[model samples]
Target: MECPVCGEHLGDAGQVLEGLDRRYAPCHACSQARLDPRAPPPEAGQPCACGRRPLDQVMAAVHAVLADGGGLAPGAPLAAVGTPLLHPFPPLRSPPFLPPSSLILLTRYATPSLARRLLAEVPEVRGVVADRGIVPGVGGATHDLLAGCDVYAEARFTPAGPLVLYKQVSTCHIEAPRPRDPKVEATDRAVRRVLPDVFVDACAGVGTLGLAAALRLVPAVVLNDAWGPAAWFAGLNLHANREALLAGEVDLLASYADLRDVPAPAAPEPVAAARADQEILVYRGSLWDLPPLLPVAGLRLAALDPFEKDPDRLRRIARRWQDRAGGEVFIP
Candidate 1:
C-alpha cells in the first residue's frame, strides 16, 4: 500500500501499530490520523503520506473530485434517498482536512436546487464530526443555491495526486450530521449579530459566525481561537477576503495564543468591535479565571462552552454576568 503522507509507493504491506486504533495508521512522517478500509474516500489531515497537506492542495483535489462527481459518471443516476454516505468527524485537534466518512452524499430529488438551499441556510450542519465546513464557493462539498424542490448532497474529498472529492446522493431525509455543534455556533453568532458596534470573537472556530456578523453588523471585527489550527484558519479566511476586511468593508481580524499576549491593535474601534459583538465568552479555563465583566461596562453577554458539561461552571459564569446590567449568561 502507498504511504498516505509522503505519497511514497510502498510494498503491498506496512506494519500495523498494535496499541492504536486499528482504524488509524501512523504515516511514515509519523502522524496518527485515521485510515478506514470501509470508508468512502480520503479527507483532510488523514495522514496523507504525500507530505503535502496545504489547504489549497487539499481543496483543489476536493473540487476536482467533486467536479467529476466522485468517480460516478455524469449521467449516472443519483443515489436515491436512504442511500448511506460517509459521515465525517471534525478535525479540530489535527490538521484541517475533510474526512472520507464525514458525510453521506445523496440526491433524492434529482435536482440540485433544494440541496443547495439546505446547505446554505441550515444554521449548524449536524452530525458532522469534522471541525470545519466548506469554503464559500459554488462547487464544494458545501454549496448555496435554491430551487423549487430540495435535494440532499453528501460528499468527501481525499488526497490522490490531487484532492479527490467523492459524493453520494439520497432522496430520503437522512438527518444531516451536525459537523460543529449548532448551540456553540449560535452562542457565538448571537453575540456578533446583536452587538454591532465593535466586537472580538475570542476562541472563534471556523469563524463563520464572527465573520458573518462582522460583515453585517459591526464596522470592525477581530477573531481568535485558542487552537492554533483554528487561528490559522481565520488568517487564511481573512486573507481570502482581505479585500473587504482591509477596505473597512468587513472588520478587524486578529488571533493569538493568549488574550493577554495579543498585541493591542493600533485602532481601538476594531478592539471595541470584537468586545461588543459577543453574546458569549467561550474559554477552556477554570471558572475562577473567568474575567470580571466589570472592566467592560458595555459588555452584555458571556458564555463558557466546554467540551465537558459542568453545572458549577455555568453558575459561576451566570453570577459573573449578573453583577452587570444587560449581561446574560448561557451554558449549552
Candidate 2:
C-alpha cells in the first residue's frame, strides 16, 4: 500500500532483502536522518540541550504533565517514552526525525486527555498514542489503550505478495522488521518445505505468518491469538491482504467480545470468521484452546511463536500438540 501522506511507495518487503529498501521511504521520518549537532542528549530527563525547539523541550513538557506520577519517574530515559516521538517512521535505527509533524507519536506514556493536549500543543505530532498496561503474552495479554488512536500501517513483502498490516504497538508486540526477520523468514521457509494442508499460527500477531502461508497456497489455515487486539488485527490483515491471497470478499465476522471480551489465559469457544474462499478461519484463544477449532482431516503444521523462547518448551509443545491435534509444531 502507498503512504497516506507522502504519496511514495513504502517499497515491497522483497526490496529489503536486496538491500534496496534503505533507499525506499514513504516519508522522511523512515529515511536517513541528519541530527543537528546543536541538539544535545537529555540530561536528568531534561529537554535536549540544543537545537531550535529542541526535542527535549517537547519531552520535558510531556514529562511535566505526568510528573505527579503513574510509573514514569522523573529523569527516566528519553527512550522510556520515545523522546519527542517522531511522525515519520524511521526506516532504520537512526536519529529521531527532527521537527516532525504529519507523524504519530508512539509513546508508552501519557493519558488520553494529556495526549489530546500534546496533539494541540505539538503540531509536529499528528497523533499521540499512549501505551498503558503490559504487552500480550502468557501471563497478561491485554494492553489497555490508555489514549489516542493507532493509525500506523506497515507491509511485509514476500514473493507471494505484499501483506499490509495495521497494529496498535502498545497492545501488540512491536517487531523490528528487517529483510531477515528470523521468525517471518523461518515460517516462510518451513511452510514452503512442509506445504502442509492446514497451517496454524497459534500466536498470530496480526496474521503475519498464517496469512503468509495462505499466500503460499496453503489450502486450509487456522489463525488464533490470546490477546484481544491481536486477534482482531489478524482478522483485519486477512481482509487487507485479500487481493494477494487471491480470496475475493474477505469477510470479517468478529465482535469486540470475540476478541477482547475473554480474560487472560483462557478464551471461550471462539467465534470464527471466514473469507470468500472459506479456507482460512480466525479465532481468539490460547494455543491450547485451538485444536477444537481446526479441520479434522488435513495434515497440519503449526507455529507457536510464543514470547517465551525456551527450547524445552518447544519440545513439550511439539509433543503435546501432536498428541492432541496430530501435527508437527515448530517455534518459529
Best by TM-score: 2
Model 1: worst 10 consecutive residues (lDDT sum): 156-165
Assess every candidate by TM-score. Answer: 0.32, 0.71
User: Residue-wise lDDT of candidate 2 within 29-95, one digit each (tens)?
Assistant: 2323232323322332221222123344455445544543453566554445552323223234433
| lDDT tens readout by residue for model 1, 222-327 | 4544433334334433433333233222232333233222432232212112233332222322233323322354544434443335778657645754554234
* RMSD per model, one decimal: 19.6, 6.7
- Full-model lDDT, candidate 2: 0.60
Clashing pairs in 2: 30-89, 30-90, 30-91, 47-56, 48-56, 87-103, 101-124, 136-141
lDDT leader: 2
Q: Give Cα distance to truth, residue 187, candidate 1, Å.
A: 4.0
